[model samples]
Target: MPARTYPALSYELYPPRGDDAEESLWATIRRLEDTRPDFVSVTYGAAGSNRETALTLLRRLLTETALKPLAHLTCVGSSRAELTDVVERLIGGGVRGILALRGDAPDGVDPSEGDLQHAEDLVRLIRHIEAPRTAQLAAGRVSVGVAAYATRHPDSPSEEHDIDVLLAKQQAGADFAITQVFFQPADYARLLTRARRAGVTIPIIPGVMPLTSTRRVEKLGSLAGIEVDASLLARLEGARSDAERRRTGVAATVELARAALDHGAPGLHLYTFNEHAAALDVLDALGLERPPEAGTVASL
Candidate 1:
């Protein structure tokens, strides 16, 4: 049999807050770009708080490098007209891909009346914007991606129900799916199988967030609904020092990536958490090297 195809490795980034933030982000970006990711995505703040800054960073990436940039767009507080405008703006700025989401509602606002309640709605809107009728003003067929949760969504009553919702989003026009970060490779494998069974045929990239700090890992686990394996948690708890914890975390992540690759995962989606050292260390442990030049995909 031919070599199994793995999904391309990529990463998610958030826009910076100020000069210091910008400097830090740029440094991280440079390190990640050296790895030659398949693509790098820039996230938008909740309720579109960082819309302009996100766009500016996206444009900079487009102009300054050859890397394919994916922009995250959420329909949390904006109207259909506003979303359409934002889509148009991104296309006008030469962005060809988007990660669509139903972001958290603005502070103090009830989510029920939010402008966009679901990701499928945003996917549909993007499809409409890319239609031939609007093709004259827009780039042709922008690639739309949607998020998936390996573990049940925090608000979801059941994992099956979440998979069904993901399938519906794919049918509605999402080109691909990127899952929430999970520590165990098995969780991702099972989740992918369940999603396929639920009729979600798009590529489901497993998201991996390395635990660089125990406190941060615990916080992220709570937020993402990832069940930290008791054994690993115990190992972390037994660590004698902060450095030991970080080292153990890197080793754990490396093992997870190896298992994922062996089990036929399409690709790894790393959550850098705006820090590069831990991710870089994990990549090194996995024997993955940076792409030779800018915008090139890293090879196994």
Candidate 2:
């Protein structure tokens, strides 16, 4: 289970929307628990919508399961006081990692009006809040994670600018980074090249797109501001039945994952939109169905 030998694994999940969704999500959580991923990230809503439900889910993950939760905290439409409170709550609840983000603009709101304008600022703020509590923390500091873009972010001026932004986050105390969903291994290779050239030394985990179906890839890929991989989509479209489609999608993703590992990716971060089947399928195909025995892939 050495880091060089076996990459770390993680998942992205969102808060369950309703009672039925919660039950189904819990089932998925249980199944995922069996694999013992290094950590599971629970996404926050844009501008803190559904904040309570997200916190409740994180709380349950802390109490009822052995899984470590990485709480996503967005700075859009929130004040410093609010974010400080949220950080405090996360620490008090035994959470160690946070994915700090400058969330996308909500309806009728200007993105620039937020108290924290950049993810770097939020990273500094989290470190500032956690400084005094170092004595109580058994794992050293709160492991702050920030988003990295393999493709140019919609708000970015250039890919070089994205690399600069990532460097700034690292300077601001970010422990590591997880990339936004990318379609091809080349995209990741290019980003890593830019980052290393710019002196960004933190580990960057690839966010594996859940190519469970053609429709899911198109819709979520668009929403994430990444175009769907035409090659992967065409394969999904060529499948004659639902089962065949699932197999096709999983196979394409496995190839992408394998390519990423070959390129020296630290680990894979599979986006599970509250379903475990496809994510598990991709992991099993990668021969990572069981968690590593003695080492943590994500050591942050």
Predicted structure with the largest lDDT when compared to the true one = 2
Model 1: per-residue Cα lDDT over 1-300, one tens digit each: 554343487888999989999999988988887777888889998878899999999999999876789999999777888899999899878888999999877788677766678999999988887786455645458889999987889889999989998998998999898888788768777887898887788988777888767777788888877777878888888999988988998999988777777776777878887789998888888886333453666554
Per-residue accuracy of model 2 over 1-300 as CA lDDT, tens digit each = 654455778898899988999999999999998887899999999888878999999999999999999999999888899889999999998999999999886898887778999999999999999999998996389899999999999778899999999999999999999998888868888998999999999999989876867787888778767877787788788889988888887887888788878888988899888899988888888996344455646443
lDDT of model 2 at position 185: 66
Model 2: how far is 98 from its true place, Å? 0.4
The local distance difference test score of each candidate is: 0.84, 0.88
Model 2 residue 34 CA deviation in Å:
0.6
- Indicate the residue-level lDDT of 222 in model 1: 87
Clashing pairs in 1: 6-266, 7-266, 7-267
Off by over 4 Å in 1: 1-7, 133-140, 289-300
